[model samples]
Target: MANLYAGIEGGGTHSILVLLNQSGEIVYKGEGPGLNKWLIGLEECVSRIGKMIRRAIDGIHMKSGIPLKSVGLALAGSEHEKSKRELKELMMDKFDWIESVESCTDAQCALSMISKSGAGMLLISGTGSCCQIINPDGVSRQCGGWGNILGDEGSAYWISFKAIKTILNHEDGLETSLHDISYIKEAIHKYFEVEDNTGFMEIFYAKSDARKVAGFCVEVAKGATKVKDGLCLHLFCEAGRYLAKHITAQLSSIDEKILSAPEGLQIVCVGSVFKSWELLQKGFMQVLQEYKSKKNLKNISLLRLNQSVAVGAAFHGARSVDQILPLEYSKNATVFSQIEL
Candidate 1:
């Protein structure tokens, strides 16, 4: 009898679960919230994740009439060994017939999706940002990922941070382009619903809540787009540069061959930033080109999309199950069908 396997990819903003047959094909997939243990609290995160995973499994069973054999969880908060161990325990306690459970940091899952070789560099920019490199020998070098406070350079939070600063500057007459963004003004009015600048100050500045302040990015972006504000475009460009700086910083420390031309190191970009920002993508590519030209290194080739991160988590789950099931089980597994080359 073939056994079932499960994979969960949890990020700062969302979670993805995949159910795979013994073969590489994905039988079921589900998405949910980010299980950041630090932010959501360990118990709450686990409960939310448990519910999502159960939903996916239940959906798969309804479709296929079978239970999962094993579960693999890859998320942002499992960077430490203790965290990974705790996460595994959490899964084992919540799930049944789960012969085994594996937990790893999000970066490991990203690397797995790159290939079974599981060695390469990955740049992730979403609610947060980070760069990870794995050597042929499995030695890893990581840069950035300092969170939103001191780090998270080029992250969505960072972009929003700067955008808000610009807005503040405009309010003070230090900048000019912001007044044109009525959409932004509207979002602020709705969120803080202030009647004027004085009301806005009373709600935002008086309370000094960072998360509340960060919430304004969406309004700013939406408004800028509606008004055709060039300032938003400039913000994205700057976000790209900020992101590139982190990538280059890591690239500088690694061997040139890893970043070289054909057969060079493959950099896989994973996360929301890659999904949403065309300007960011263009700017990142342009900066890489300039860096390669200046350093006389070969151009880098990026492989795989950000969605692969979840695919990778599922793949890892399959691997964990493979350890117990007959090798034939994996032969029938489903590879990602919708992925474009």
Candidate 2:
């Protein structure tokens, strides 16, 4: 029988599971509820993951008793060492058929998509935002990921929050810009399904829903890309600048040799916000250029992963058992931008 491995990428919004054969071919793929242990209890997260894996095995027509060689879980809220160890233990206890279990952060799994050497930087701007860098020697450094309240700058949630604040400020006569913000105002009201300020305040403050707020970024993107609204464009540009700050903050502690390498550093960008790179390019490039002058860096490559990061989690599972999956790293990523400083 072929050795079957499984991987799960658990996010704040949703979770993805993939089963891979020894040849690195994805045989079964599935998605289910969010697996953040903080949002849902740890046991519940593990139970959901187990059910997904069992369904995948059944979907592939595998026998009920067939054992999986390994399983990898890349989940949000599992970044800390304590969480990783606890998750691995629970998965082992629940699934006796699994021989090995590996647990890591979603960011780490995303980075593994491109950097086999484990030497690269990853910036995530989804419902939340964070940046992480791993050196060639295996040491890792991180800059952001402070959740919505403390940080999450440049995230979808941030953009949506900014949009609401801008409208409120305008209504309060705090904003001096005479440029018509009627479109954005209307978009905000329609997105939250609120007819007035009182309704908006109730939904936003009473429920305090992060996902609902983050979803508004889709409207913000439409406003910028489809409607060509200036205020919406400014929000994205500002988001780009904040994301650039994450990179610069990480780069500050990097070795000078790594910064001056001829091939340059690889920066893997992940999330929904990057879909509108056309709008973000201006403010993102502007900050990068300024940082380049200050640091005298050689160059940098910005890339996007073509495949779902669940594949990376599977690769991590294979590596944990001293096995290597034959995958084309180059084909898995595309260079969106390369800056020569």
Candidate 3:
């Protein structure tokens, strides 16, 4: 029997809690719906997470006869110190017996999953967009997480907003940067099940919620790509280029004095926005490839975490206690064959 550890990766779409043994094999796993505390309320969100934890604990102890000794939670909406403290306190209150508890932004946990020694950068483009860079020394810098109001430039939300505005502009016979949404006008109308522009406006304005509205990107992508709308394709490309710009700019922002990077700098990408759409991923990588070529930084590699981010979270949880398991464990695909996503 091996010591047990647990970890969680939480996001707006879903949450995964995984328990692992000393050999880095997943022993127990539980999944639940996602709730962004800011969008919902704190109590409801924490309660949902608590249910997931309890679910995993019940399963882990039942089969293994050993409780999780340590736990690491990589949660979304934990970008700030205050939120992290609040969530940590809540976890501690419920699972007081778990030793060496740690909490960090889900993005941080995603990075820990792909990079050994926590080197390289992580760019997430889902309901929102943000980038986290961690050098070998553990110091990190974050960019673009201003939320829907101020930033999140390359996010799905931004794309959805822009698409709606462009459609509206086209409907009103006004000039739009997209030139003409005329090609996909019928498709967009049918997709949203709206008869006309008035219905479109009413429905969009009524939804009001950021996540629900951002989901419009799915239709936007489908409509634009089906007809090969130049403007929509350009938007996706522009998004990729903008994300590339952030990546390059971070190189200059890192403090060289305190940080160290390993050979072949890795760019680990996580998020449904990039993952769900082939055109968008192509657009992003095409621009990123161009950027790499221009800068002659061929050491850069872009890799997506195909497995669940929960795998990363669980890896970090076990890593905290074991310390000897190579950080590169997750990088090797073979290591996770026994654990299904």
Query: Would you list the C-alpha lDDT of every candidate in the order shown?
Result: 0.65, 0.85, 0.66
Point out the worst 10-residue segment of candidate 3 by lDDT: 332-341
- Local error of candidate 3 at residue 179 (angstroms): 4.1
Q: Per-residue lDDT tens digits of candidate 1, residues 113-206?
A: 6455567787777777888877667777778877676688777777766665566677788877633555455555676666766765655457
Worst 10 residues of 2 by lDDT: 254-263
Q: Give the clash count for each candidate.
A: 12, 0, 0
Candidate 2 displacement at residue 169 in angstroms: 2.7
Query: What value of lDDT does candidate 2 attain over all alpha carbons?
Result: 0.85
Q: List the residue pairs that clash in candidate 2.
A: none
Model 3 regions lying over 4 Å from their true place: 1-3, 58-67, 95-100, 177-179, 191-207, 255-263, 276-278, 281-296, 318-341
Between candidates 1 and 3, the TM-score winner = 3
Best by TM-score: 2
lDDT of 2 by residue, 1-341 (tens): 58988988887778889988889989889998878787678999999998898889889888757888888888877888999999999989988898899986665677777766667788888888889887777688888877788889999999999898888888888885445688889999888998886786776678877788899999999999988999999999999999999999988777666666676877888889999888888898889888877775768888898887888899889878888887887888999988786
lDDT minimum window of 10 residues, candidate 1 = 332-341
Error of 2 at 248 (Å): 0.3
